[model samples]
Target chain A: MNPRLSLNQATIKHADLATALSLTAEAGITSIGLWREPVAEVGLGRAATMVSDSGLRVSSLCRGGFFTASDPAERARALDQNRRAIDEIATLAEAGAPGSAPVLVLVAGGLPAGDRDLASARARAAEAVGDLAADAAGAGVVLAVEPMHPIYAADRGVVSTLREALDLVCDLPAKVAGVVVDTFHVWWDPTLPAQISRAGAEGRIASYQVGDWITPFPGDALLSRGLMGDGHVDFASITRLVLDAGYTGDVEVEIFNQELWDADPAQVVARVVKAFDETVAGQL
Target chain B: MNPRLSLNQATIKHADLATALSLTAEAGITSIGLWREPVAEVGLGRAATMVSDSGLRVSSLCRGGFFTASDPAERARALDQNRRAIDEIATLAEAGAPGSAPVLVLVAGGLPAGDRDLASARARAAEAVGDLAADAAGAGVVLAVEPMHPIYAADRGVVSTLREALDLVCDLPAKVAGVVVDTFHVWWDPTLPAQISRAGAEGRIASYQVGDWITPFPGDALLSRGLMGDGHVDFASITRLVLDAGYTGDVEVEIFNQELWDADPAQVVARVVKAFDETVAGQL
Candidate 1:
């Protein structure tokens, strides 16, 4: 299980809970990564019970971090939602119980509407996430701050690099805050090798996800990710870097191409499993 | 003229040389940047005469850098092309003569066909640009390394940040080499402020191009730029940084939007001049 595969729900966003669970189980993947939307649709309590019954390990919850709003009310609302998300992770589904905390992944949001102060947006994100420390710790959840690719810096997340993300959570406890190293987001970074090593040294690598970099990325850019072997990411090299840095965690595949979404859930799972075995797991 | 304005030819791309010349002159802009393609189309000799006759100082030449082919022959060919481009900058066209050199802005080419080693591609670009130093210096030309946005890291340019570009030309003499600070590209960089300061301190701010960062960028991403006031870039701060850093050069506006391209040439010139006055020149 050197490269234990965990399928992030975003990869198969169109699938329902029962189908997704069955597909992952059938594919022989014992671990999973859930999205809040899908979980809510299935009713959080029932979904938690089902995952517990099926003995599926939820590696992490998909989101929680849009604290860069200018209005006070909006800012407070985002924090409240994140707190709820943290609470959800606490009692959320996991391998053997209905109340095991999954790592909570945090996507630092973009600049507030009509505001161009990137520094302030980032500052607010750091403060808000810091504020959530008490609730996350109380719920026994780890918060992983995800620094998206720089292209997303304008409309999505201001935390555009590992160093920036680490700086944001510099004061937080290691167990309560960390960073997600997704190949899609960070593969282009020249400083990635050194940063990954530093993250490992600091015990800040909460998740090590893999995705490939493809060309002529779609207009949206968000859906530009391809299957591991289908695109150009150097999986062997990146995986080695992570492993060398002491990251012994689930290697999640989170492809977002429209073609993958249109495929039959079982076929998608089989393809993902095979891809993991060859492109990612093979590296391990 | 602390922040003297220069209209890059690309900003009024649809205009022919005659109209482009007349438009810039009519708009009261004494400086203009030219592209090799348009210059070639207008007959280099004639184009040089028109610009010189119109009393427009050529602040810079659009490009010269694609030396990252895996094929030795192709790479050699790119180098030869760049050498020719350097010659073009030195002799093709200018303010008052056919042989006066302007600052040549160079964009590092992306990966060679079927190559995934971005580091190698960047290394190749640096070596190529370094090789051009003697020719650039001999021709009284300066090579400005323009680091495009990270989104262009795949198909267009591998040099994605000012810091990386500076690293590439670190060994070259300041007069023969420098960096291009385009707001559309480096504005998203978290490390931009410090890098710009360093570029200025090192006399590496060869050209400071201004354009706004608009959202829902076009599918091409290349044409996503808008007029100064039409987008979200903070021109005031960026302009201040440039002035503080001892760069008393022309601030060029290089917008590439479909609508702007479709507008009347004179109207486009008027709009650009107005935008510069309001969004950029006003800062001075």
Candidate 2:
């Protein structure tokens, strides 16, 4: 197994923190990217201790951003939630082995319900990142904005491209905010290579996620991510671009397929290891 | 009803060419964008006659371009088919009432089965458009490249943004090639305003299509488009940009919702008119 391969917990959606860590270690992978829900279930302090016990690097914390709300109270609650997430990321990263990235992956939420003003929603999302900049910087945590595919533009994310995500954090220092280059979301961008290069040059590439875009999307658009080699994404080429762009971080395998989530966790980890080696691990 | 309003035949998918024309005329829509499949169902000449008899203008032809095939035989067939479609567009435009536009909307097909070379596939799609440029120009028709949303990037269109589509025809005259600004596909783009401005400035805005991007995409992503004012698209703002950028062509309402398709055609047309009037037509 590749040392830089990180098993993002979402790949084994039902696995508890202890189980996820055990699976990664047993599979010989050295890194793990965790989600807030599972972490919260275990309690943040216990989750941090679990990470220390596993002796694996925490590539990133799954998420912390849905800042498109127009209601002041909702907006304030979102900000407060993000600040807590930033603190969680700081604790988790500290508990992990050296080289762990203190990165909080931020997914800009979709438009506010019944709101058709996309520009204003996008502006609010950017402003929210700005609002969180100080908290992130103060905590030595990086807010990595993950721009989702345009398909989720209405309900999941308004930041639909790496360019837009990077634009939102341009004013902040790289240590305060950056971007995640998730293949599932950005594989179709014509400006991908240029933007990846720009991200590397600007030192804003805080995380590198690898996932395949499968065809015949499932009934739920959110579960459309597939195993690496089973879909149409050319991992070798995209991995090459990422390496060329100087992103030498852990290549996190983050798939969100219903079938995979239902499969045996150990078997899924084994398959992910093989797929990563065959498709993207070699480039890293 | 807005004189510039055009009913794209796909909005009434089950309607044959005759019924589609009658519906458009009865609904007070001054024009109709056609689909070749329905036109082929009645033979081109007779379909043209029906369109002419209806006394409505032809805004553009629905499609012609699946040119991402890797096989030489497939590529030739795609180009030949596009050429025929170009001739059909010319004939239909000539038969329609005055102000008819000889335009063929081209959907750049997805990657060939099992192939993941997006850059190569995109290049081929663009080259195919170049191959058809002469035919389109000769027929005095414009081949309008319709950039579908990135959600369709793998299986429907490799050209996923207005910027990429415009770049493909940058060297050609607007008369030979242009772009279709379908709001459903591009409403999520942060760069939409700038791209529309660029399209108008370059005289490449061949068609301005209106559709809505609704949430919880139905099981089939293809049928995800909702009617105008029924989803998150801010049509009034987009229409203002198009008008401000100087695109005076038909504002064609093209939707693909299952419910809308199953609804009474007259009622659907009425709803479209009301939606367009409330959401987009006023800006025109």
Candidate whose DockQ is highest: 2
Q: DockQ of each model against the real complex?
A: 0.64, 0.88
Compared with the true structure, what per-residue lDDT tens digits does model 1 show for residues A220-247?
Answer: 6778898887766778888988989998
Badly placed stretches (over 4 Å) of model 1 are A1-3, A93-101, B1-3, B92-101
TM accuracy, model 1: 0.96
Q: Model 2 compared with the native: what TM-score? A: 0.98
Which digits, one per residue and each the tens of the lDDT, describe model 2 over residues B1-284? Answer: 89999999999899888899998899888999999999999999999899889999999998998999999999999999999999999999999999999999999999999999999999999999999999888899999999999989999999999999999999888889999999999988999999999999999999999999887788998999998878889888898999988998888999998998999898999998998888887787
For TM-score, the strongest prediction is 2
User: For each candidate, what is the lDDT?
Assistant: 0.83, 0.93
